[model samples]
Target: MASPADDKESTPLLFSPKGGGHLDPANNGVSDGPRRRAAPPPQPLETHYFASKFDPPQIAKVSTNSSKYRSENLATPIVKKIYSSYSIIKDAIQPMTKPSLADEKRQGKIYYEDTYNDLPWRCSCGTHHKDGIWLNHSDKAGLVMSSLVWLMIVYAGFTVTLLVNNNSLPSHVGVIYCTLCALALASHAKTALTDPGSIPKRAIPNEDNASDPTVKFCNLCETYKPPKSHHCRICDRCISGMDHHCPWMNNCIGTANLKHFFLFLIYVWTASAYALVIFGMNYFLCNSEECIFPTGLVALVRLMTFMCVGALIFTSNMLMSVFWGIMTGMGTIDRMKKQEDKTFDESEEEPMAFTDIFGIGSYFTWFLPIDPIFNDYDSVMGYSNAERLQRERSTLV
Candidate 1:
């Protein structure tokens, strides 16, 4: 220790003023050395890139204090409301934009192209048909045969009701003949117009059952054929439970229209028989004086007689074949192929088999031209793949 004044003079100052040197008492509190300018206040990092050739490239430092960037990030009340509204609208319209698989299936638009586009007509039960009303453009022979049958019916009806005996036939006789003819025509129309249980082209029951041995693929229709379905060349499609192509009706007899076909045969046969019996009664039982006939009338009668006989023979054979098929549980095609016949125990199974074709309905309804109760896409196919699997599982247990 020195004295306090000497010690203060010897001690170095921690901070200098604007000048580089400390204050000196001999200079009257002024900086002793050269005066130095003040260093500028520290500026923001504006000059980020290095312009010197020797220096490496430097990354530009971004300022977080930018008004433009800050405005974008700011969540005002309007922005929040707009974002919430956009989210709600997106959620609301998502369902209509993306339909579910079950909804598509119910619309009948799944897997297959629109077949009803070209076919504008629908049946009584809302089934689409390519052939409108009664005409089949593909079968000219059927058209000719159908026309001939109609001609026969008209001629026979006219002869029995109005021409024979100068329209002296009883009102009930005409009524009966007309009723039979009407029923026959109705059944015929129904048979001709009804779809023959056609399978949808390119329909696949299941992707998993692709390897199943029983599921046969049709090259022509490009579809998997279900059990008992056959490809009909005339119809140019696969028909479920196909019996045969009928020239008279100009339609394939199959699961959907077989009932109408059977009824057609029955009504035609009854009408023909009634006409024949009436003709016989008028000709054979009448007195010669009372029933004298003109040469033209006699010729007409003879021609109609032959027609009646022919119709009787044709209808009888068809009825027999139909009955055989019903009893044997085989269609005409199945019978022709000689597939192993299913034995018919008439006592126990006949009614079931009969009702299977005609439908489980009142006896009176069976004769009428009505749609079959079980005639549908699912029923015609017997069962779906899932149902079939379930049935097999149940049977195994």
Candidate 2:
């Protein structure tokens, strides 16, 4: 009853041709050619949200394989890249901000307290106060180990001397051996008891000389640091011409005590070598039947032999290291830090270097455990006595 154009308009097409085929309502919502099922209703897209600023922005992901929603997820990678770049930029600039005082305290950046305060004994040395002959009380383990080493040395020396006395060896041989042991013990004591040229705690640099290249600030000690000086955490102080901290000595090897440390090595090596030679000769030359050793004596001899061998090996290596350091004009710390002494001229300064550590005296004196005499003692201390006097005068004024 209706025209084809009128019929098409009145038919109310449920599906377009682009959607596969047109559906006719007149055929009960069925396709004109073949029947086609109705498409399901569109579901809501799932979205992921990130809490951090550095994380990617929220993105919707459709369950269906629709390209339209997939295009939205593409922006997620770009947004993430932007956030990551911003985070990196922020981190790079954060350190530029000066830290507050509270921040420093929280981070353990506060200045250290006076190292010598409340000590049992203190002595005035020229313009500064120094600790007495007592070993460092802070390090109990080091103290115990050092005591054990001293006892071992004494025991070994006694045993060796007794062996020499009982044997047909000359009394002078025993005397010389005892002298070597005494020297070694003395040197060890000097090394342990002497202050390793510790810089005065809380020493302030003169305002006029604040720009001096040799004067630097120590954050931990909160004091002026002299050239070639370093902070020893164990000693809790700055040491002038710091070489290394020796746990065996329960002290640091620095400008003041380096000579004693070196001499200790020398004497220990000499004594150990002497003992080994004497022990060897007594064992090989003496008749086993006539030269009978008691069980306790034999045990003591074996222990001394072990001690001698260990001392020989350790002292030899340490001596070589000291020689190397002298030749190069560098300390263990300097070598470790790879800091080269620009002023060092090996050929010309070699003799001077020896004197610097051992003091200005006879070569024999260098081998003795004695305080070194520097040409410029004030220079070794990092500040001149003249400067101190001037500062004092100004303060008085």
Candidate 3:
């Protein structure tokens, strides 16, 4: 039996519905304190690759760090794409191999500097000329034939000239005809006798490297040759400014002898034509009595007889001379054009044909031996002389 005041005071305070911490899905707010976390379930070990970017890709165990925190993310999709692409190329490319020590040692071994540098530059001329150096040259027979051919042409021209007005033309004509014949004979003799430029006998120092653009060494002759030079089978030596072997001239057509060579053709052809015309005119213009006026009747008859026999030979020779001149002219023009174009233009794609350069412009320089001029041109003849110096300078650059 407690009094009313004590009973009221002892009763617990009742909370309002709005202010109370009630358990209702709709009305309960999130708690400020951290919620309890459950223990994670055991996860199965997954395969992975571990490689440094600097090393070759390889199969590797899952690294401790990678496995510890890796979760289901986009990395697996990216890795799958990489593997699919890489698989296509893997078979084509082999694993890189390391070089062995023995291989490296052999490659790095050294020897005497000039031991390998002395091998002769091989040439195709070896087959044509078996005789080495100056022993047993093959051009002796050609030389004799060449001399005889020249003499025959001179004799024919002289006979016609003498028979023409007792071997004397009116006024300056005789002098001119005689001068022409003499020059023709002299030119032929000089061309046949002169040595077409030969390579120096001394070995070119350090001339082993074929890739060296400035110098070309001839292994056949064991000497150095300049550009546009070749070994002659008959001459058994390296000839500079090599044009071609002419059995008729009994010598190689080369740079130094070209002046006389080209002139020889002009004189020979003109002499033959001139003789034929004079002989025919005299035969047609005069009757039998006046025809033998200069020489005795017997000598005149003999001269006429010789002319009949040799007419075919002279005609054939003149025609051959013409053909050779045309070919040589074309070749020279072609060479000049190449040099000219090479000096000015560097972007040329197709090479000009050796024959295509023969045209009206080239005809002007046909008789002139302009090799001297072109030899000095911006070095078009591939290290002949100045070109060597030019190449050397370019290497430094």
**Candidate 3 residue-wise lDDT, 1-397, digit = tens:** 7664333311111211223332223322222221211332232133122222222123334454674336435578889999987986775564433244345458994222211223354433221222122222366787676877666766655555565556333435555667767777777766665555566555332222336677767887887776567887777777765667677777776654665676676766566556556566657776656554454544743564465346446536645643543444323333455678875332432342222222123555544433223423222222223224434546666
After superposition, which runs of candidate 3 have C-alpha atoms over 4 Å from their true positions? Answer: 1-138, 164-172, 201-217, 225-228, 287-289, 293-397
- lDDT for 143 in candidate 1 is 78
User: What TM-score fits each model?
Assistant: 0.59, 0.59, 0.43
lDDT of 2 by residue, 112-209 (tens): 22223344565532212444453576887878878977997899768867766666455788788889889988999988888888776556554444
Worst 10 residues of 3 by lDDT: 9-18
What shift in Å separates residue 160 of candidate 2 from its native position after superposition?
1.9
Strongest candidate by lDDT:
2
TM-score of 1: 0.59
Model 1, which residues run further than 4 Å from truth?
1-135, 202-212, 291-296, 339-352, 375-397
What is the Cα root-mean-square deviation between model 3 and the actual structure? 26.5
**lDDT value, candidate 3, whole model:** 0.51
How big is the positional error of residue 107 in model 1, measured in Å on the Cα after superposition?
Answer: 16
Structure candidate 2, residue pairs in collision: none
